[model samples]
Every structure is written in C-alpha cells, then in structure tokens.
Target: MATIKDIAKQAGVSISTVSYALNGSPKVTPETTERILAIAKELNYIPNAAARSLKTRETKIIGIFLTDFSGAFYGDLLQGTKETLTRKGYELIVCSGKQSHWMLPERMIDGAIILDVTFDSEDLIRYADRGHKLVVLDRELAHPNINQVLLDNKAGATLATEYLIEEGHREIYAVTGPGSSYDSKQRLQAVMQVVERTAGVQLHVIEGDFNKEGGELAAKAIMAGRRDGQAAAAVFCFNDEMAIGMMNYIAEHHSDIQVGEHIHIIGFDNMELASYSQPRLSTIDYSKRKWGALAAEQLVKLINSDAVENERIYVTLLKGKSVGTSK
Candidate 1:
C-alpha cells in the first residue's frame, strides 16, 4: 500500500531521494536512510521481487526437474543437490510436470539440473540456444551452455548380466525400462551385447516401465515359463524398485519359488530397500548423491560462464544372497 511517493511526501524529500535511501544507496545520507527505513517499516513496505531480479540479473536460485516423485530413488539425490547449491550461496527448488518446464525459459531460475525424461531434447537445445545454463542427468546433449552428469548405465548393466552369467545362468530374463528412457536403452544394449558373446546364453527381454507394477507383471511371466521347484533361473530387473516388486509378488503367491533358490534375481540402482529384503538383493551400485551433487556443481559453473566438463558416475556390482549358482 505504501509507495516511494508516500515516503518522499511524508519525509519532505524527493522521490529519487526516497528510492536511494530505501535501496541503501551511499548517495543518500545515513540519517535519511534510517528515517526512510523507519517510515517503510511503519507502512509495511515490501520490495518488488520482479524489479530486484531485473536489476541484479540473477535470482540465486537453481531448479532441479524430475520426471516424477516416486520410491526412495530421489531422496538422496535431491539432498545432494540442495546441500551443494546451498553451500554455494544458492537455493534449490524441486519441480515436476509440464508447467514447471516454463520456469527455465521464463528465467525464473538462474540455472537448472534436469533428470526428467518427459523433457524433450530439442526443447532443452532451444533453451541452450537462448543462453540458459543446464545440467542433464538422464540424457546426452552437447552444447557450451549445457553439461551432462549421467550414470554409467552400460557398465552397470554389464556387471549385472556378467555376474549372473558367472553364476552359470544360461537362461537369463532381462526386464527393461521404458523404451524412451535413455538409461534403459543403454543398459539393455549392454546386456544384449554380453548375451550375444556368451555361447549358449539366452536373454528373454521383458518390457517394463521402471515401476513396481511392471516388475510384478514380469514376475508373472517368469513364473509361467518355468514350473514350480524346477531348475533356478536368473532375472535381471532394470531397477531395484522392480526387483523388489518381483520379490514381493513371488513371496506372497508362489511359496515354492524362492527368490534366491528357485528364481535367482539381480537388480540395478542398489536402492536402500535392496539390503533389507529377505534375501538381500544383488544389484548394480552407484552413488546417487554424488550424481546429483555433481550436476548442481556443473550447472552453477555453466551459469557463471565458467568452463564445465561433462561428468559420469561410475558403478559396481554388489553380490547378495538373492543371486545363487544355477544347478
């Protein structure tokens, strides 16, 4: 309700003098600034955020975009991003859905870290063309304004598949994530490559959406293919969420088909729940927190017009009771 005009009129000063005093400009005397501040407090004056942003040309805020908030996957990642950004004098805002995409183009955030598969590569390129700095976690895009901090999906998948093969699994089931997913495609390609090279090995590909329901459905298919209490078969679920889903389904419905016994299983992501399962889930391990932290760091560098190199989070294979040697 209070404007600079009102403060100037009450203080018996010009509007420009009021503006300078309110902004803490050294041009205005300390006495004038203190008087103007007291009047602003009495009037409950609030500075305009839009005007401040325009003058500074920076908001000191970074946005992290995710495809959707689900499972235990995003917690550590977001924590890493927030801690890194906060330490660097910036704030982090988590966003999702189509509406949040506008935040980048509209210049509401200083920079962005993207892991949302729903975001098109062309759109990201367009944003780069407009000089918006970005760091991508789920896909590859080469541009000076854009950097990548992606997982080593191919190596993780290879480790998962090779571990099963070393355990003498010939008939392996490979549950895949969404077709459009870059990680899925990379992981599946690696799995197929290993399978082709291993003589007498067969890989049955099952389509999945990287969700629990997809894992449950894949479980049903696997169960149908083999009889109860027969020779054990190995299954490689694309992600830990799906692997846990399959384990749950088998435990509830098929008592005879034990996870580590009749149906050996392996998964990727090494999620927290993997260790707590009845037979600890064998999985591909990587540092999700570091993945997020690096992305934030890269985005900040890009925003500052500093040189930034693309980054990759490495992976390892963690053996567990969920995987057993085939008879």
Candidate 2:
C-alpha cells in the first residue's frame, strides 16, 4: 500500500532522492542514503524487482543451470554457491535443461552459472552467442565471452591413484562416469597415465554413471578376478557416492576386505559422506560450494561489470582413514 512517493514524503526527501538512494546510485550521499534506507526499512519497503529491473537493467538474480538435479554430487556443489551468494545479497534461480526444457532466456537472468549441461559445443556456442554474462563449471569450453571455473582433472586424478600406489596397493581399479562427462575423461586419464609410466602394475578399468550402483558393479566385476594375478588391491572411484557404494558391498559380502590390509579405496569430489563411510573414504576435497559461489560470483561480476573476469580454481585432496593413517 505504501508507495515510493509516500516513503519520500515521510522521509522528508524528494521522490528522485528516495529513488536514487534505494537504487544505490553513487550520486546519493552516504548520510542521505542511510536516512532513506532507515525510513524504507521502518516502512517495511519491498523492492519492486520488475520495476527496478527496467531502470537499472538488472534483476539481481543469478541463474543456475544443470542437466539433472539429483544426488549429493550436485548437492555438495550447491552448498558452496548458496552460502556465497547469500553473503553477497544475490539470489539464485536453478533450472534443469531436460527434454522440453529450454534455456532460461536472458530476460529472467542478469547472469548464469552453468553446470553439466548435456548439450556440448554448440549449446555452449549458442549460450555464448547470446552475449549474456555466463560462468561455466565442470566443463571445458573456451570462449572470450564465457568464464570457466575449471579444475585440473588429470592432476587431481593422478594424485588419488599415486597416493594409493604410495600406500603399497598393487592392482588398482577405476570406475568412470557417463561418456559425455568431461571430468570422466580427465579423471580416467590420470589413472592411465600412472599405469603407462609404471611396469608390472595392472590397472583394471570400467565405466559407470558416477552413481553408487555403478561403483558397486564396477567393484564386483573388477574384484571377480578377470585381470592378471589378484583382484584390485585398491579402487579409485570417480565420485564419493560410488566409493561409498563400493564400501557397502565389501561390508555386506566381502567382510574379509579390510581397508589398508586387503584393499584401499580412494574417491574424488570428497563429498560430505566420504569421511563417514565404514572404514571411511580417502578422497579429493574440492569445494563444490566454493565452485558454486565462485561461479555465481564470476557471473555476477560479468553481469554488473563492464569487463569479463575468468579464472580456474585448484582442487585439493582430503586424506581419510580409508587411505590408511589419514584422518
């Protein structure tokens, strides 16, 4: 029921002054801005997103696009974005691109944080073509207009495998993600690189959906003894979900498989549950939430700013009991 004019009158300021102060225009003095804000708050003023967008060309909303909205894999990542955005006073709008799901046009978003969209180069091209502020995470596509938050997949993958090797594990097995996943290639590449550089060490490889069931099946087949000599001395899973599933299988069926003594397992993504798994899981602890926040932050900067800012973030490893002596 209260209008900007009413607030302006009540604050003893002109309508233009109230408008400039509320919109955060630099022309408004700090003292006047504080007074206007205090009055606005006392009146419980609600900003008109639609009306304000028309004047400033901003909705103050960031779009988060994902392929599928399932599992802790993404949940962990959202954790970072949510916390970071909240602190910065930006709101997030999440949309999934499946089937009839079209991309959220620029009208709904001032900027976007993209993750794991099924469409490849062309979609990214079209996305970039729109000339909207965009930040892509977990995918490798380069463009002058697109800001990417990427990781050293090969390096992180190699670190997990090499850590297992240093722990005296001989035979290592790996479970990869969907073929379309860029991370799948990078992580698997790390495993093979270690295999090629070493002699007499066997690497058992399998592919899965980056889910728990996939890891369980990969574990069963790899441990079934089809490769040279013994079963996998250790398994390095692509994600923590798969690693947890593999551990569950070992607990229910292969009780004799004590981690460290029998077989050690390492996983990537260092999910919240990784440390809680039976013997616990050793994993790469990259901040998915940080990535989310960073992605959102970058997109916002691109949107509000006149220039583009792009950079890559490094992921670190979190040692756990499963890797032996790590906590």
lDDT of each: 0.90, 0.76
Off by over 4 Å in 1: 2-43
TM-score of each: 0.90, 0.80
What is the RMSD of candidate 2?
A: 4.5
lDDT of 1 by residue, 181-259 (tens): 9999999999999999999898899999899999999999988889655567999999999999999999988997778
- Candidate 1 yields a Cα-based lDDT of 0.90
lDDT of 2 by residue, 1-327 (tens): 677998899989899999999989999899999999999998888878778777877777777778787678787577778777777777877777654225345355676777755646676667677776677776766776678888668878988888877776667788888888888888898789998897766787888888889878877875676444344377888888888888887777777667654678888887778767767678887767677777767776666654656666677777777444222
Best-performing candidate as measured by TM-score: 1
Clashing pairs in 1: none
